[model samples]
Target chain A: MSNLFANQAPLLRTKTAPAAAALIASAGIIYGLVLCCINSLETFAVSFLAVLLAAILALWTFVRMAVKENDRGLLVTGAACMTAIIIVTVMPEGLPASFHVYRSFVAAALIIGLCVATLCSAVYRLLGSTPVAFDNSRYPILILPIVIALISYGMILFVLCLNGLPQISWQLISTPYDPANAALRGILNDILGTFMLMLLTSIISLPVGVGAGIYMSEYGGRIAGIIRFSTMLLRAMPVVVLGLAAYGVARMAYDTAWQGILAPDPTIMIGRGTFLLASAFLSLLVIPVITRATEEGLRSLPRDLREGSLAVGATEGYTLLHVLLPWSLPNILTGLLLGCAEVAGNVTVIVLLCGFGNYGVTPFTEATSLAHFIYKVMFADRSFRMSMGNYVYAVSVILLIITLGLTIVYLVLRNKFAERYRAH
Target chain B: MPATVEIKHLSVSYNGTNVVKDVSFEMPAGKVTAIIGPSGCGKTTLLRSINRLSELTKNCRVQGEIMVDGENVLKMDTVLLRRKVGMVFQQPNPFPKSIKENVLYGIKAAKIKTDHSDIVKSSLQKAVLWEELEHRLNESALNLSIGQQQRLCVARSLAITPEVILMDEPASALDPVSTLKLEESIQSMKGDVTLVIVTHNMQQAKRVADYTAFIYRGELIECNETEKIFANPDRSETRDYLEGKFS
Candidate 1:
């Protein structure tokens, strides 16, 4: 065991020189091997140089471990693995071209295994003692899954920014979309259309969701159970089914006398697709989210708040409005913003509604959304993807920013309310 | 003016089982009355019946007449009954609003057109919290300490000008200093509003009550002057309970 004072200090701070060197070399090997798997000839040359440098560092540390009579099993294993990687990488030219593709995979697997072993041994030496090592390993072991998840999300964001930032421009954001004209092509129509859809969806869903939630929580009865069951059923039903139902309803409205009264010009509102129809269906998608959130929020409040208000002679409705709703405002807003985000990113209902990009921007017009545009431009035609894939990526980034921005607002508001109320 | 409460043949049952069986008592007007009993002895159940708050519970049945002043509470409109008789819970439950707003919640709900500022001032003064909280009337009531919150709750109940106030173990969750402050507020509200406090603390009952009622196993064992009940009780069950034979 290490000295008591050394144990008292942080493990990383107390790491010996050899341990630090092994840690750095192992990290370098893992990074270099990842670069080699990128499948680009230009990066492969640079990646080999990185591997060579890391291998030299590992070999030097092996000599130091041998001289100091320290743990040498990991160093020996690391050196042998490095040798195997270098041989496989260098001898790829001697095999058939088809065999060369598999060469890098073999080298990457070997290097990853070695780096993992070297890192474990280095950390073990830093931790010291069997019981201390076991105790300390728990932190990283438990945190590893979340760390991997975060990295995956980070990689996606990084890739989006890399491919989309340069494509973004004032023209792309402000001009109308024109397929034949490169300079005139833009997503401005879809951007405005998406916002309008979000506004309409919220307008349609908020009152209904809040009312249903209040009924289920405050006036729970047989009817409330029925409402709860319907909401759960709606939440479980697929969006495509909602879209089809919307389509059938729109078709019926157009075919009947209502269309003669509402739409003398069929192009205005009675077409196969319109913003109003898409938003109505999207609100169906968003209602369940808001209702469940509102229900959960109200249910979580202390009974004392409700009983206290009622005890003061406030009617059930009055108490709900004044005490119950106000106390659970943060929770309601969280669900609202989450629903808004869901509305902003949804494409399925709109895709079934219209092949948007031809109509003017209005609630009754056939307007598309960012999500729909991305799905269309990416999957509708291969040639369009090759020429304008960057635009698709740009739309993705915008949609991500909008949704993430709403989520952040919800979190901030929740924290503010949580601090102010500090509910008992 | 403070109103007297007359409970006769009152029995409360939950799920077909009686919790308070054939209990009857009288709480005099303009006086502090304390009910002391063991846990689940129907002290709280009887207190809630005064305002019909116990009816909020599911499968709960209440039978018999509880008269406040002259009217039977069982047939009274709940909103009107609750406004006439206010309540305080064990934990300090201040609404999540400014102190002024919380004090005016009942008035606003009842739509009573009155001078709001005067009511706010007098209610806080009556609860003995005006000096400490006057400057912070606009602040959220939840920002107050537990003790202050309890007083704020009292002020809230007072704002609507109720004739009776029922407190269900109002000081059970308070610290010693807060408990003393609450007791002082109960004493100060005497003669203007009838106060019925339910407590397990024998000392608290003896300190704040003008009259004491002892209940055991959902029955009213004894009711008399506080000094007399503590000195010489009528029922052996009341004496045994007072001696801490069973709690």
Candidate 2:
């Protein structure tokens, strides 16, 4: 009996191992597939066909190996595999329903790990265990994290769409929200405020940010380094803190006392939580993005272009205007769009300054964005939330569209510029 | 229209390290002068000094006078100096603009108002690019082949009608065919502009240069007619460099 078992080991290494690997890999794939869409007849039938194919292939390999070797151990191993398969098919109720879900999850995880190991060993054998084979084996492991991240993001977007898509309507977009009347309920004022705020922020920030960026990249002195460090410090500060800082400045500028900042009298006329003040604060958030973008854009330019322009008798200023600035316009625009996106989604500053804005949109009016509107609606009243819960997702969907739209536009413009000015 | 460049007791240093030490030579007007040496021998620095282009390097100091048209280039306004003396680099660096615009960039930036189309035509004709690119003058300069781009760069320099054109290994990045085309362009511009070319290729110097100067270790080793420098060099280093004893 010892001699028979010892002889069977070599046969198992050559024939049985490959068949076992194939069976496990197929089982894992089918388990994952069925888990994706349970209770579907088509998925069950496909998984059944997949298992049947693996079994036929494994049987064919065993018959060939048995014919060539004529070993009794091969028959014994094949009989064991057949018995295991029969038992699994006939006695499917091995656990209760409460235990079934977690049990299958654990089983699926183990099977996936086994499949990975099998593939790695196969690759090692094919490549003779070289370092290249080791490197190749690591690729599947490296891809694991990326796959997890992509699936998580996909599921989040899927949930968002599933909950929010139905709540959006033309009426919900074109009217203003009114607590007194339900028919006039919409986010038009919030949308207009958001657009105006973005525009005002851009107006205040673009020149300063772009100029600072150009000076830092083109000039390169101690002052530029100091400016860069200051911007970095500002960028690191929390947005909520920046809101308080803006409030303090508004009070100082309006000649109001610090204690009266939150509840200034009508006569003080500080325009607290106005779009102008919000944008002024938002510019602090935006300038750094634009500055970094501009600096990066300038730096990415080929040395040849700058030297070529200067060598042709154009001064530093002239070269910047004609060559450097034009070449980096797409980069600057990308920064601007990114800054706009950041401004659009930001509600931290708006929430601290004012809860909600029901007034018409203007630079001096109380400011509220789609993000702020969502926050206000969600936390205002329990009854209100229950009555209009879906509108929160609807506003969330609109905000997502705005930010996503800006990003998509930036990508398209960047690609167009890259194609237009590709270095030869 | 051509002018001679005279370098007198010129020494250049970068961050307290000397690269070109007291090198002195004169490039004659309306002639092609080739400065040849191995890599890091200060041949390019010597050429850049003629146009004050070495000032572009940070921490660089120069203690010498480069005279062109009886004026000291070291003391000249860099913008005006560069306009008077144009340079062509190793790689083709055309602006990302139309062909006509590239040729007219310098003139426009200098605010020299002339007939734009005529200057563009003549400049391209002088660079030997007019025949091929006349119809496509509005096309982007980058779409051209590397050889064509180099010539377009030459045309750009010529559009300003500079007295001298400095070339720093202009054919080093080019394939043999492109190199040949660049050589043809150089030949076409001969006598119209004083051309100072720094190259490592001895055969290229022999082919285009009327005069050749050999430098080694940042010092002028020999200067003579091209044939004399090749056949019977005055310095042992120049002889060894020509005989392939040392790169």
Candidate 3:
């Protein structure tokens, strides 16, 4: 026992310097590697692309951390997306040119990253659990660097594989949107199309969902449980199954409404009646989410909320609108995002209903989505047909990026809305 | 400021069982009436019946006539009736809104067009919380201490300009400081509004009550002045319940 204290002191001290040395060396190695990559890569294509990809990934990661930090579960999901992107860079194709910039920036970032992480870890260890010494708000702004590093590290592999994954840069802003250039238009079109679809669908669903949620919560009574159960049961069936059901209904509508791709004819194929089919499909895909979310939100609202309003002589209608709906907006929006997230991936149903093979025709013929753009990109050049596999990986990144962006944006707005209306 | 609430042989039932059985009481003008009883006696039920607040209960059924401010409250439009009969809960339940908003809840809901500053100022002053909270009126009501919240609730009730205010053990959830503050406010509230409070604290009943009613097992046991109830009671049950003997 006498020897134990004396022996342990030097041993502990010795262990400390080595750990610190290892961390320093690792950061130094990353910095050196990044600068080397930046110096070697001289191409406009790969270098520029790598910068764009890295920055977007980092921004998405930062928002994901900030908005969804309410739960630890998002960490797993964030790690997975980052790791997947990393794996993409390390693959055979090599990252896009933008990777060189990303790596260079990352190497620059390592020093800042090491200091921030160490400080935060110490803060949490020393004061995080203790009461008077610290609080969540008083914690440092060090989270920013950590998010950037994780994103840069994960994107490194993608940059390597894509010939260079691009972190965001002024180049995108400088790059003109050239309508005459089909290649540029394809990328732009995918982005615009996804954004518009998501925005419209979300707007339509919010009021309808929030109102329904407030009503069912406030007034659903004994039947609310049953309404909730059936919605969950529906959710239990896969989204594709639900999407197929929408597809079938759409097909029947097309056959009934337009026989020859015009009104009053009843024999037209599914793709001809695109507008009606899309709306119906969109509604069916998202309504279940709206209904289910509202039910849970209403149930979760404390009884005192309603009672407080009612006691003040506000009728059920006023209480429901002003008090309940505003309070439940954040929760309801999360549900809407879930719906949006679910429906955004309906490539199978879209393909089947549109009757387009792999690539989408124009909206007048067969409107395709960004998700399906890879098919056209790879196959457009017969020489690149064998490497279509790369396109798969590339398009997947884009899809994930969009999904992550929408999710993060919606979540952040929801939180701000919740905070703004929080009772007073 | 004089108001009369007459409840005639009122019986309240929940899911078919009588919780308040044929209770009758007349709350005279310009006085504080306290309904004192053990847990689950008809005191709270009786108070809720007066304003038809019991209507909030899904299965609650009431067979009685409640007259307040010349309108039979039972037959009166509940939205209108509730505006006249304000209530404070056992816990301080301020809206998660600012103190100003919480105070304005009833006024805005009823769409009353009273003088804004004077209405707000007087109401807060009436509840005796104006000076302490004057600087923080825009802060969330929930941010206030529990005692201040109770007083804020009183201010909120006063803002509605009700003829009578019902409190279901208003001070029960408060610490002694808050409880005493509420009692002082209640003492100061008389002659301005009819106050009906249900409490288990017999000492609190003696503190500010002008008229006292003791309820037992969903039945009315006694009704008298505060002096008679404590010193000389007409019933043995009131004595047993008040004396620290078995209730």
User: How large a fraction of the reference contact set does each model reproduce?
Assistant: 0.77, 0.70, 0.54
Instruction: Summing lDDT over every window of 10 consecutive residues in candidate 2 chain B, give the lowest-scoring window.
Output: B48-57
DockQ of 1: 0.62
Tens digit per residue, CA lDDT, model 3, A1-424:
3665453211111123223433433443344435444644322323332332343334334333433223232233234335434543443433786655654444334333333333332233234223443354234444554655786868765664464234323442123223334333224444444444465566666766666566666677777666667656655666567456655655565545442221112333443334234434565557668876776766676776677677767898888777777777777778888877765665544544432222222222233455544554444444334423334454455667778898889979987987766643
lDDT (CA) per prediction: 0.79, 0.77, 0.64
Residue pairs with colliding backbones in model 2 are none
lDDT of 2: 0.77
Model 2, span A1-424: residue lDDT tens: 3665554323223445445544555455456535533533222433443453354445445545644434343344345434434433444435676544543444344334434444444333334334686688556556655765787788778888888889888987888766667677777888888888889999999999999999999889999999899899989998889877766665554544532333333453354566777888899999999999999999999988888998889888889998888888888988899889888989776665543445667776666788877777667656556556678777777888888877897889888886676545
In Å, residue A103's CA in model 3 sits off its true spot by 38
Greater DockQ among 2 and 3 belongs to: 2
lDDT digits (tens) for residues A245-354 of candidate 1: 87676666675665532222365444456677778888888888888888988999888888998899999989878777777778788878878888788877766565
Superposed by TM-score, candidate 3 places the C-alpha of residue B145 at a distance from the truth, in angstroms, of 1.2
Angstrom error of the Cα, residue A131, model 1: value is 7.0
Choose the strongest candidate by DockQ: 2
Alpha carbon deviation, residue B3, candidate 1 (Å): 1.0
Estimate, for each residue in B1-247, the C-alpha lDDT of model 3 and write its tens digit. 6589887788899999899888787888778889998898878888877767788789999997778866788788777777878888888878778889888888888888877677778888888898898889888887889889988988888887788888889998889888888888887788888998899998898998999999998888888898999999999889988887963
* Model 3 chain A: worst 10 consecutive residues (lDDT sum): A9-18
Worst 10 residues of 3 chain B by lDDT: B47-56
| All candidates: TM-score | 0.83, 0.83, 0.69
Q: Which stretches of candidate 1 lie over 4 Å from their true place?
A: A1-136, A178-183, A255-271, A379-390, A420-424
lDDT by residue (B1-247, candidate 1, tens digit) is 8999999999999999899989889999999999999998889999998999898899999998899999999999999999999999989888877899989999999999999999999999988899998899999887789999998999999999999999999998889998998888888899999999999999999999999999988999999999999999998888898998864
